[model samples]
Target chain A: MTRARPLITDLLGGLVVTAIGVAGFVESWRMPRFAERHADPFTVPGLTPGLLCAVLTVLGVALILRAMAGRGGAVAIPILEWPAGSAQRMIFTIASVFLYGFVLFGNVPFLIATGAFIFIFTIGAELLNADRELGLLPLGVGALVLAIVAAFAIRFIFVSVFLVRLPG
Target chain B: MDGFFQFLHAVVAIGLSADLFVVVWATLLGIVIGMIPGLTATLGVALVTTLTFTMEQNTAILVLICVYIGAIYGGGRTAILLNIPGTPANAASALDGFPLAKQGRAGEAMAVATTGSFLGSIVGMLGLAIIAPWLAEFALDFTSFEFFWLAVFGIVLCGQLTAMDDPLKGWIAGFFGLLVAMVGQESLHAYARFSYGISDLEGGFGLLPVLVGAFGCAEVFVVMRQEATHLVASKVGNVLGSALSSFRYAKTWLRSGAIGTFMGVVPGVGEDMGAWVSYAAAKRASKNPEEYGKGSTEGLLAAETGNNAAVPGALIPVLTLAIPGSAPAAVLLAAMIIHGLRPGPLIMITQADFFYSVVAMVFWASCAMLVLGLLLTRPLLYVLKVRREWLMGAIFVLCVVGSYAIAGRIFDVWVMIAFGLIGFLMRETGFPVAPMILGVVLGPILDNNLRRSLSISQGDPLQFVSRPISMVIAALVLAIILFSLPPVQRALGLVLSRLPSLSRKNGDA
Candidate 1:
């Protein structure tokens, strides 16, 4: 038999979807109406979205019920389990992305930021995964060289060949 | 006859010029892009679209088409070498291709894949060349009601076909995507929608950012979750000899090509479905069915042919009806619109030679893939050895650059990140993303046609089902839903088994 998805995940996901859907419904209703413009009744801007929100809400409720049923129908309790090792990797990836996209690119010289990010990211990932036998210093040096070359190559391709304007 | 001669003349002109270099270069670039695990044919075309913005419209489109075709074909190499499909379309290929690689026949598998791709492309090109004009002419009769039905049918069929395991979830994802498309000022009213007073939301989520986010960043996160990746060395031997042996499966090649082309003509079904359905069909018909999952050459050929054929198959609807048959085709449609070539029923009348030009482009791309696939086998195998961590970091940078380059909107970058997270979550769950993409592309058409159909009938919704074409489409949709029901399926199976003729056919088979 297939393993059921944890109850907490589904229940929480359902609640979140339900909240969004209800909010969307309210907002769609609050939008300026076609009555002022004397437009066709069918031409209302909120028609599709209003309908979609209703559907989403219903689906959310169905999901909640399904999760309850999967938990043997009487339990309202939630289940939780943390994955091993993956949480760290996920956190690191998200943080690195936020730093690169939100904080780094426009704030500093493009090559410096990109090179540093790549070098550090590569070295960190290599150490964490530990698939290779190279010493840390040697790997770090190789990563830095690779990062420098990659940064320059990307700049030349995007800026010169493609004529794209890059953030400073 | 005159059109044919003109098309021939155009082909000859292009064949002789420096512009052919564009085809060669794009094909090579496409192969590299496709061989990368995170990058897809859609991304390759989208990235190239930006680079070709300043070129002539014809040349620009040619570059994109070549890249699209080459990328789809090129992904087979990674599937064979790494047991990881370089693109989602190559998933079926990995089933047989990787097993062959494990047996030291990786080069042979690559050769078969290339030959199949070339033949499949030829079949698809023929369909586009001969059928697109007629299909465009027929599409001229479509009204608001028919268009509305077509959009719904596209979304429903895509959801059902792509997410066969759980189509309801597929549909929810699709409708959610449609709602996402409704986030900006609408076309008819110019009224702000789900924007919530945010100026960036009013401008709307650009497709490029959403796509880059969904396919690229999301992929990085998935790879991050994996503990390790393994790469193996492949022996390159007798590529031509192995490729020639694929001729023994010519019937499977042709049948799979036809199946792929038909699937492509169904909007949003595209290469992945084509490859999977063909693979399934080949397995069903094979004499050595037990050999299928364990390294069957015929299985590899069918999948490769089906997907590569789907490239041109996907183009058929785009050229004829301004509707994309697949996600990559949606990007192609967008690129065409940016180049001031609006594809629709009147495209055949307005731009008579465009279809032929595309056919010629596909032909050259096939030739390029055949040459490059043979030549670049060893280098690609070497590339497969690159660690995912470094590559993932590099890919994220490209994603940022690609997202920001579209309209120079910082808001779009944020959208990319948000959607990337959403896409990752969706992947972790069983929800498919392809249908959502189709819905996003088809949302405007659905919205506009629904409103227009209603208006035409003076607020009566019944008119949607009243029109002839609309009725046919509605009936087809209803039929599919009905057949998919478990009780009905079981009943039909029993009835069919009881029928003497069907039973005899089954028994004979």
Candidate 2:
């Protein structure tokens, strides 16, 4: 009940770490050593990375071993347990972030893109609020107002005040 | 003496100028941000760093320093009233603070916290002024070998201390951060390591964006995923009067401040540990240990003092060694570079006046926190009442803008989101993020130095530990790793458990 995934999470985490380590090491080995240019062998671009990936591989193995031995399986990892309705909230948050970062930004005008994102986010979050204080009309109006003010304030601060050349 | 004069000059100049007003507002802003549950000191400093991009260098650093100090102190108020620490650093404060609030002594608890924080900041500021110059001078003789070992030591020690229970995961995070830092072009060769033919990958990940993502955007997800918290104490009574009364427990604050300052000096292990260590020490030394978690004023004072003092304590390494002592200090270090200020072994010789100005900044920030905290105690409770649903959207938008404003690249925004997910996953998996952040900061230092050292030493690994300083640091790194191993830990536990029995048997004999 306490552990989110128990020994299985560590088992998976170890496998992933080990895979990353191997991939990284292989990639490092593929990097140029500049032997054709008679560059110093120790100064190869891949030297440090190769060494780090080797160490990582060993640590990953150790983690797997520990998990197999039932060590570190006593308690739950932090932030895994949550109240009801958390999954929906988390999924929505991830979706919103993805849409804004990958699609909305750099595609639409900064003001509209940012305002639309904020407005949608605010209203969506409020609707998810279990203890709703405001009715539909008031909530919509409030969300719209907040979105407009916050969006304008952010744009002004970044562009006009800070001189950042943000995307249109 | 010369340094003291420069310190005095900087203090007087800042006090007399328009910067005084900046101090008030910035510190106030930091308090409000800290008073909120999800906005951490790291996030606060990072968001504020974006704003300072257009200001003069010193002014920017000033704004950041004020925010750093104020945020640490501000978190204590939430711990007192809501029984939830506004920041991780204030978690220890809640042990005593909440009980006192439940006992209808919220005002007294806050007063003790304020006084403790002020004292801690002053003590830490003194440590910074005295320690930075000496450490800088000492580091002047360090070769690439020493620097390489220092990076290893920072990563290892940070991993060990930050994840006391699970050093394995901590080290994993640290190594992963180093790997992340390797994804761009190397220093000696301009070849991109893992760019995979992508154009944006050549320039590498921006530090600010990664930070904004990990601390800021990740905060949004965590907040949304959790149930909301409610405030306990509806009223904060007689703040000013209660504050003055805390001076009676001078011993606790002083001891905690000293311990806190030392903890701050340790790389990547910042204010949270500072408060915890100080609180533990205060409990150990207290005459009435039973009163510790049940409304003890002294415990609250120690926790607050220790955390606040660590703010200045954390700055010591950032100024002298270009290594951050905490997560927030990491952002500060990056901001220093952003503002065209070089911080390293030669900083004392190169930026003497600037160093003194930082000390003066800490002084002013502490004073501002004290004044504002005591006077506006009751009014500040309104901050805790704001609903998360209403606040999360604005906070997320700021995270986006903070990342974008840094380099004005949409790619950076993507990096922020990516790291935010990585950070969220890291937290959920029980891996400490600070070591990873520290690894990202120290990766280049580790890489360049190791490669350079090997080139000079002709591939002899022995040469890496030849120097006295390098040997000492190498030994420390080895010791930490060895002690953290599961077999070694179990053996030590068995031996320690047997020691008391052996002593008793000897007594019986």
Candidate 3:
């Protein structure tokens, strides 16, 4: 049994883009006609989606051709045989980011969250393939220092100076 | 005359005040940001622009100018130290710079790069001061049709110049970017094109998110996927010796600086093209063209000088015509607008003092770059010792925070992720990202201007060519497209080969 080519993904993406571009072109073409009907012009005059449709059609064709070409040569796709626990570590890193957004945005202070996020991700990744020379203590300290400095710097410069309001 | 004195007073006062300190600090920070693999000069300017929103207009302008100069200069560091260029502008540097590093002349290469960058910037500044007002007057004549052609020219030129192998790929990327820009609401009407009932999509893709995706996220993915390689850290030697060597090759310095400044003046063409074109031109004119990629001091100098000079050149259009010559300049234009400084025909009349102040800022920024470059050479060398994984991890955090911090919206974060994936795919498949970015940046301008021009003509298509500026721009665009054709290029090359008499005439003259 052979694995399926990523044709479904390609077709779905292409169809969606083509439909949107065509719809936009049609709507824009009728805009002037519609504007005349309504006392006030409902559309932007002279800016139709014809150019956009032509460009999109060309792009859609190119994408389909590329997808048909499929995966070529062994060197094209490098074999990345990861260490035993690297996948889990990678998942954890991505998860931490999601969690930070969901849980830590308003409740936890930025510096604390940043420091914790970096420390956790770094430690988790390192644990997969332990290196004795790279001590946890130094890594933790470095991450903390960098995170604290960056958080404060960003706050002071963007908020205090620029008056930008950032979420806690 | 009174206003002149006030401008002079403003410059002197600003120079002596803490504003100078802020400029220096911002320049240093920009250098660091540009020296990092995942951070670019555009991002550096955008980040700093937000930070300048509340400051005095002059101070803000000063800081932004410093960052622009420093970022362009700083990109050379990673290009020299590692084979990987820190920013796209430094890509040409890597061709000669990496070889120089391997041969253990990294310090000398860096020194030459710094000196060349400094000189190039100064020359560009001079051109800006002398030529910008006249150019601005020329730009004042540009109406809607001219602007439309200009935007199209920028996108096409970017595609032609930046694409390594396939110009078609570059154009495709650019078109894709234009398509992306078509998302959200149209500029004139509030009608959403492809929002698909999603409120978040209605706002369209943000510049910060798209930039972060293309530059920062794509870089992270590329680095992660690549096999880990070690760089041989070189010692920092006498930088002054390298600076002195630049003067020894005065011809190369002058030629490269001129090339850089010319490339910079063209709207939408940035420092990357400046560096590559200068390198190619230098190699072609060199006594030994064969030594180009093999640690040639002249090659490295040409690349560095052209890129740095392109920085000030890029600013001329933004200051004069309200047209950004580069992505970084676009961000700078936004910053200027945010500070209530409208850059157009009336700019010189309304804010002559501010214009002069910008010229002064450019001069000061170059000096700051030189000072900081000398001081930071040894210190920044330590960055090479950092582990790739550690650096990547930290950069990842910055990318996330940077994207989210721009607008306090989770939607932007998602946009960043989506675009990051797209950028990664584009890179993996050998599609140039620069064209995509150019398309996104110029899309609205093209759309708006094309519409306006048609409206002015009351739906007459011939109006596009009737205007003088538009005609010239259209002709140039057509010429560029024709030049890209193989037969036309071959014929042109043959004609060029028959120019020995022209060369001899020059020698005789």
Better of 1 and 2 by TM-score: 2
Q: Candidate 2, residues B1-509: lDDT per residue as tens digits?
A: 99999999999989999999999999999999899998999999999999999899999999999998888988998899888788889999999999999999989898889989999999899999998899999999999999999888888988888888888888998998888888899899787888889988988899989998988898898888877788888887878888877788788888988889888988888999999999999999999999999999989998998999899999988998898999999999999999999999999898999999999999999999999998988889899999888788889878888888887788889999999998998888878889889988989999999999999999998998888999999999999999988789899999999999999999999
Chain A fold similarity by TM-score, each prediction: 0.85, 0.93, 0.53
Please give the ranking of all candidate structures by lDDT, highest first, separated by commas. 2, 1, 3
lDDT by residue (B86-133, candidate 3, tens digit) is 778999999988888888888888888889899899888877776777
Model 2 docking grade: medium
State residue B211's C-alpha deviation in candidate 1, in Å: 0.8
User: Ten-residue segment with the worst summed lDDT in candidate 1 chain B?
Assistant: B226-235
Against the reference, the lDDT scores of all candidates come to 0.82, 0.89, 0.73
lDDT of each residue in B234-289, candidate 1, tens digit only: 57787888989998997899989888888888988899888998899999989998
Real contacts recovered, all predictions: 0.46, 0.79, 0.19
Off by over 4 Å in 1: A6-16, A71-85, B485-509
Ranking by TM-score: 2, 1, 3
Off by over 4 Å in 3: A1-33, A36-48, A59-112, A125-132, A136-163, B1-13, B227-231, B392-394, B405-407, B485-509
* Leading candidate by lDDT: 2
